[model samples]
Target: MTERIGIVGGGIVGIAIARALTARGVGEVTVLEKERRLAAHQTGHNSGVVHAGLYYAPGSLKAQLCAAGRVLIREFCQEKGLPYREVGKLVVAVDDTELPALAEIERRSIANKVPRLARIDDPAHLRDIEPHVAGVAAVHSPETAVVDYASITEAMAQDVRAAGGTILLGHGVTEITVDGDTVRVATDASEHEFTRLVVCAGLQSDIVAKLVGADPSPKILPFRGEYWALSPDRTDLVSGMIYPVPDPRFPFLGVHFTRGVYDDVHVGPNAVPALAREGYGWLTISPKDTWESLRWPGAWPLAKRHWRMGVDEISASLVKRLYFGKARRFVPELRMADLEAKTASGVRAQAWGRDGSLLDDFAVDRIGPVTVLRNAPSPAATSSIAIAEHVLQHHLDLAAT
Candidate 1:
């Protein structure tokens, strides 16, 4: 194995891949990150809830990896002495209309092979688990956890470095060309050649894939997920995570309650179109980003599809009462005063097809010397280790030959 594996992106996924490749003693692993530090984008901005593999369809990559990733993540956290907690998640059906969907979710969880999942028929049982939540029935997924993903990413980078791998910061890859047996990567700083390339460039994944002469087909539509942290006095409004039954038509999970690893309760990560790729707030907009959003064919279609939902989200975003009111539906005790405008937003690197349909599964495409990840979201943070393994098994090993 005389090949060097060049990875673009320094987010958690890229860091995990680098670490995994290094541990395998795969010759040389070079990670080129555009930022000064790792996890500067989506990895650092998320709600920090490790997924429980409950929401995705059975047999999909998202379901399998998320279920397996939970165990792997718990073990990794324990081994590394990292901070994490498997506090569990509760998906509530507030009315009879949602029970069928809730049951389907439970069935899907079983199919995904997640452990400790059960249906709570009695409101008393729901109250015992989540005292503040109001629901007729709920699905309890106790394997879900929360952690500082940035910390995990940092540890992965350290492991890569210790394994004689190079992490190049502040180096944005500008161009890529495949020669006979080598791939040349041109960055803003310099150029390097590698025997293979793997791109996990979070928000820039589609663009980076294009640079490698791949079909650059999936368009990365960045959706800003904004959160509201509960005021310290009102932190007891809910225990663990309390989620609503998601809209089947949409790719996003509805706004829910998240108790972070830091002990703060987060609410309202409403899916809204972002003005900038790295936009974290209502006012954070870029000229180029605005231009891109205006021109993306999927933008109008997505907006049209989610028009009413988008209007409601914008209303919630503008009105604090409306935002807290939504949260109050799940946890009746939560008040408007309990909410503080602790604004932190994550950019979901959502891949959209040319016809404007949202891709709902983990996408991996390999062409010649390059392997691309076009759609990696939600459980991507939870499933990163497994995703790395999957990539290595399916793409890297094959590309090496």
Candidate 2:
């Protein structure tokens, strides 16, 4: 008898898994999404950059999967005739102080075997790469590119449908229970019974995991990343993606400039502790979400440790000039006037431990037939395909089973 599989969350990761399972003839695959459409949350609001395994640590899942996923996504885009542009990326160091961090990043990139990675030290050559960028030195990854992840998610959903899977939108999973060998998933609209279940609830991962009696130590803390698009006339200032050498203390890549697939330029995405789990703006508050985050055992200590950075982030969110000044460090020509209108913002579903440490790698928890993706941010979109494969091979242990 074929096993029935149920996947919660219609984001790229869940959709990719559904597609992978259906293609492998694993079982009947049904995807449950709370929203009316797929990719409504993190997957939709992302910067759309296909990461080249430059920043991840060597031999890590992120490093392995990102390198592999970039190839897969490129091939998938080519095969599907989707837009995949190798616009390249520059991880810039504005002064001598940042060079050490930049060098460490280059070392990791080399260890990860990122294709066509080059170091640019001469200011003249840096100008040749990014004409307006004011960085003293940089590491260029020519293979870094951008694409519409929502489009990719939709295409994967199409593949799932074509392979005899079902996608149920507007079905928010409220609970999950085990009954002997079968798993029952309860949504607001209905209950689904399946032999196996996978929960990829991005922002609400921890909440969903608890429904199935999973540990809640690593709680989800939403970090809202606000963005500003450049005026149409100023879009020419950035030919490709320009990023800062990420601070070793934090996971955020810092504010930078990026040219989208549609030829528009955007700046920022300053990381600030969100008021709620899905909070996109200062006014969008959720009392329950706020309470949960604050009440977490780890929240206080974590805040105490990073209070200064947190203050800076929140200040930048409130002060447009301060936010613009960050990007202006590398893009000297970028003026406060160049910031056009506010664009759609994204909330990263970052997981934090009770010990006040942030969870760095992709975390998967297997409880019987239920597999929960606890923490998958940033490169998760880039690593969706490979993540699906890894889930199948390791988490689900399909072959052994």
Candidate 3:
């Protein structure tokens, strides 16, 4: 019997899976996206950096897939004539206080076999990489890159279409049912039945999983990250990407500077609790989303543990000076005027368990004919293609072999 496949969400990972199924001739494939356009959410709103195998724990899925996906992305850009910039990245320890954390990052980088990874202790060498930046030491990944992820998503969609896969926009999955060997999915406008179903429903993963009668232990927490664009004239302050050693206690990387593939410099992405799942700013609020989050058993524990950092992030979001202060720590030359305007912001669907601990790695759950992605943030865009292959081989079909 031929396989009939249905995919939820039209983000890069979802589209990539559709494209892979088509390429493998795995029967009829269809992609459902809630938005009218692909990559309308996290995929489009990301920093556009192709993450190297840097921060993930050794032997984790993130570390493995990121190493593979980085190569695949560069090659895809070449074949599709999309812009791919290898602008390098420096993870700087701004002072002695940050040295221990920086060393752990270096250890991970080397264990992950990050290409061309280097450690610099001399302040002058750090300066050579990011001039006008103050740091006691640093770990450099010179092959780190930036690209247009949304464009890449469209390109993959083209492949899926070329292979006769159907992609439906604005088709949010409203309900899902499992009957015998097939999964039935109803959307806002239409319905589909497939031999197998894969849910990559970014921010709505939990809701969709609930529809399938799956465990609801891990809930999606909306964390909005805001960015500021550097004045075009002063973009030279950043030649590539300058980053801080992330706080291990939290999943967020601190505010840093990045030169985008288009040569625009952006600062920030401080994480704060978002009132709505899709909230992009302070004004956007959803009572249902907020109340659900507040009442979750994990909410208070998570907040109690990180309230100080949350306050700091919330403070930074409300005041430009505080945000500037974070960025200023990386680049001493960064002026208040240099941060010209607020750029696009993205809300990450951070998955937290009932215990309130963030899932730090990629997570997938299989419920008979349906597979749901519970936690796929950050390195997800970088690992989209690999993620597709993993899902197809492990979750969707195993008997074909």
Candidate 4:
């Protein structure tokens, strides 16, 4: 219990782990964050949807962890007096062509035991849930909710501090050295050693993995998702959250409408390749990052596999008309002008293998006393607490309870 434990990345998942450790009297916990604050990257940038385990494969880590984490997040929010809204989500199929995919989603939702899952075939019934939405069929997840993840992470950090854990901001890990049973981590400002180490470095996960001499096979491919905010006056177009049946070929949930915790609706997060790991816009580029991705063995193969989708997504990013067209599919009432502007963008740290396939499930790797989270996308924030317990129990061989 006295052993010093270090956690890299001050995102929700990392802080959740720290809180678990300190709360259980597991160790002398220390959290090192690169930025001067926590939740600076993907955690802060994502649409704050507390998912209801709808899309993941049955029995997968994402499905299991997300189901468990959703309850924990809601309970945590309630305990901390944070904002948590169960606004519900409806995944609609616009026509007969999309019915098969919508059925698959329903199958997955049922198999995953998503709470209060329902399938609606009548257009009038769908309209009862979302008056503006026009679809022939849909799978509704009434338990799907929204919350401010950054605020939740801050609350988790508070718990860690309250439990005697140290959280060091502005401590971006530069080097990691493992010797026998101890791991030493170095930052620009200071250095520390720990009896156990956990890496939850979201966007930079693969980069950090290499620091500990782990395999570079699963490279982090930064994919930028751009969102357009709905006009404030027109936010009423979306009742809760409206989604398309995801393209299953890729991991990303395509363009959709989500009414946030604060009651503001945002639409469209079309995925595109990011030139820099942290790049939010097209103008921001990192030559080194771009070159590294281009040279990866998976790059060419992935490009060949998804060139059409790449073209469509890139065109949508460049042309407002195209993006609006995609968004207006479910809501025929949407106008080109209803999409105010590009409100915010987040880069997904999509983990890819040398064979050029995206890793759909959560992935973790171990090198001695160090445990690294390599691929954690969309549901990561939703699954943060459960992921912490999972990592502790499986990779570190520490029972969280």
Candidate 5:
């Protein structure tokens, strides 16, 4: 007998799981997407850089999965003739103060076993990799690549369909109920029944998880990351991805420059507290979403701790010059004029605990047959395939059988 499976959210993670399950002949897979198209949210709006396991702690799920996922995604992209470019990445340390953090990153990268990872201490050698980038020292990850994740998600959807799966677009999941051996998923248009359900509802993860009677302690706090495209003339300034040594105090990777698969360079993605879960721009607001964030027990404590950072982020968001200044740290040639226009922004569904702690690693909760992806931010797209394998083996307990 075929086991029926329902997956909520059409992002890369959910679609990747669907493809994996169908390939294994585990069950009949059906993907439910709220939007008219797939990858319309975080997956679409992301910077599309494939991480090389540089920042995660050693032995953590993120480190394990990210390292494996990069290889898997590269292979998948090759097999599908997708656009995958190994443009490389340099984690630059500007001053002696940042060198310690940069060294720590190197240690973590070594522990993660990132292939072809090299540390460059000579200033002249550092300039050889990225001539425009200025840094005292740098850790270069040559394997770090970029691809169109939205296109990959679409290809995964195609594989799901070819393997006898169903994909229903614009089907917003509103409720989930578990009744003994079966699970029922309610959407705006209709309802679905299956033996198992997986919720990968990115921005709305908390709400969707709660609908299925999952814990709501680690609430989702949306952080809008706005990007700026480099002017066509200045695009030549960046050869590849040039990033700063991330501040240990914050979870954000800080503002950096990334070259896309098409060879266009982009800067920024400054993290700011978003007013709504789906807030993509300054003008977009949701009163209810704002109230929910404000009312959460963790919200006040989190605000108290990070208020200064929050104020700084807001100032940068409001002033383009301030934002450009942050990115100019690595590339001194970058001017306010180089920031031509704003690009698409993404809202990260960052999870926060009642104790006011940010969940840094990937989190998933399983309540009976329902598996909820509570916190899956950066590297989630890069680790989608590995995450699917981990979810099936650990969370869903389907690998052994």
Candidate 6:
């Protein structure tokens, strides 16, 4: 009898893992999703920028997976006849203080083995690349690109289905219990018994992990990223992706301009604490979920460390002009009128450790028949293929044991 595998979550990462497993003929794979359609959460709402291993720590899973996955993604898109383009990105140093950090990112790129990462020393070059940008110096990463991940997710899900894998929508896994050789997954629709289970629940990862009896558990603190679209007439003011050198101590990349594959420019994704896990806007809070977040020991430590920055981000989320004003630093021609609230926001399922430290790397934990992905943030979409392979290899090792 073929081993049956049940996967929870229907986002890009979940489907990517399913595709990888099915392609390898691992087993009969089934994906469980609560939403009526796929990619309704983080995967659907992401900025759709193909990362170039710029901000990740050198040699970490994020750096390795993103660097390797960028190549895989571009190749997959080309082969599948999907629309994607390497529009490149510019990380500018707006002042003297940010120059060192910008330089460090260049050095890290070399260590991460990203292709054609050059530091632009002349403002003339910056102006040539992005005509209406302000910067003394910048790092030009030509490997960066943009593509709709929702489309990519849909493609992967199709592959999963064609490979004889079943994708079950509106099947939210409400109860998970593992005993002996059979693992039972109870969803709202029905109960499924499988030989093994791989849960990539995204925002609900920790919740599912706890159900399967795992420890040293990290809390998935949902962070809302808000974006604004450039008025159609002013779209020409920005070209390619423009980013600010991130503060070393901060977890987020500062606000900047990004040109979409659709030829529209979007800016600003200021990180703010989200009241709901899947909530895209303010005042959308689940009391139970909010209580869990507030009670988590991990939450207080992170808050204590970045209290001021957190306060500022929260304030920016409430004020639209403050958000756009930050973006205008690069494109001075950008008027308050140029920025308008785009779609619903994307929620980042950021994991925080027990000590309250934000887990920066890809944190995967396995115990017996269960494997759970704890923290997988930016570049996760870019690194989906490589990460899926890693997870499969782990499963293979367990089978050998």
Model 3: lowest-lDDT 10 consecutive positions: 392-401
Residue 105 alpha-carbon offset, candidate 4, angstroms: 0.6
TM-score per candidate, chains pooled: 0.97, 0.99, 0.99, 0.99, 0.98, 0.97
What's the CA RMSD for each of the models?
1.5, 0.9, 0.9, 1.0, 1.0, 1.5
In the range 1-401, model 3's lDDT, one tens digit per residue, is: 87889999999999999998898888899999999999989999999999998999999999998998898989999999999999999999989999999999999999999999999999999899888889899999999999999999999999999999999999989999899998999999998899999999999999999999998879998999999999999998999999999999999888888899999999978899999999999999999999999998899999999999999999999999999999999888889999999987999988998988888899999999999999999899999998888887878764373
Against the correct fold, how does model 4 do in TM-score?
A: 0.99
lDDT score for residue 350 of model 1:
90
| Model 6 stretches with alpha carbons more than 4 Å out | 396-401
Report the candidate with higher lDDT, 1 versus 2.
2
Tell me the whole-model lDDT of each prediction, alpha carbons only: 0.87, 0.92, 0.92, 0.93, 0.92, 0.86
Candidate 6, residues 201-255, lDDT tens digits: the string is 8999999898888874688989899888888898999889999999899888978
lDDT of 3: 0.92
What local lDDT does model 4 show for residue 126? Answer: 98
| Per-residue C-alpha lDDT of model 5 across residues 44-110, encoded as one tens digit per residue | 9999999999999999999999999999999999999999999999999999999999999999999
lDDT tens readout by residue for model 1, 1-401: 48889999999899999988998888899999999999999999998988988889998999988877777887888989998888889999999999888888888888887788998999999999988889999999887889999999998888999999999999999999999779999999989999989999988898888887776568888888889888888888777999998888888888899888989888968888888888888789888877876687777887788899989888888888888787888888777878887568888999998768888999999878888899898889999999999999988874353
Regions more than 4 Å wrong, model 3 = 398-401
For model 5 the TM-score comes to: 0.98
Which candidate model has the greater lDDT, 3 or 4?
Answer: 4
When summed lDDT is taken over every stretch of 10 residues in candidate 6, the lowest stretch is 392-401
Residue 12, candidate 2: alpha-carbon lDDT: 94
Clashing pairs in 6: none
Q: Mind giving the per-residue lDDT tens digits that candidate 2 earns over 16-52?
A: 9999899998878999999999999999998999999
lDDT of 5: 0.92
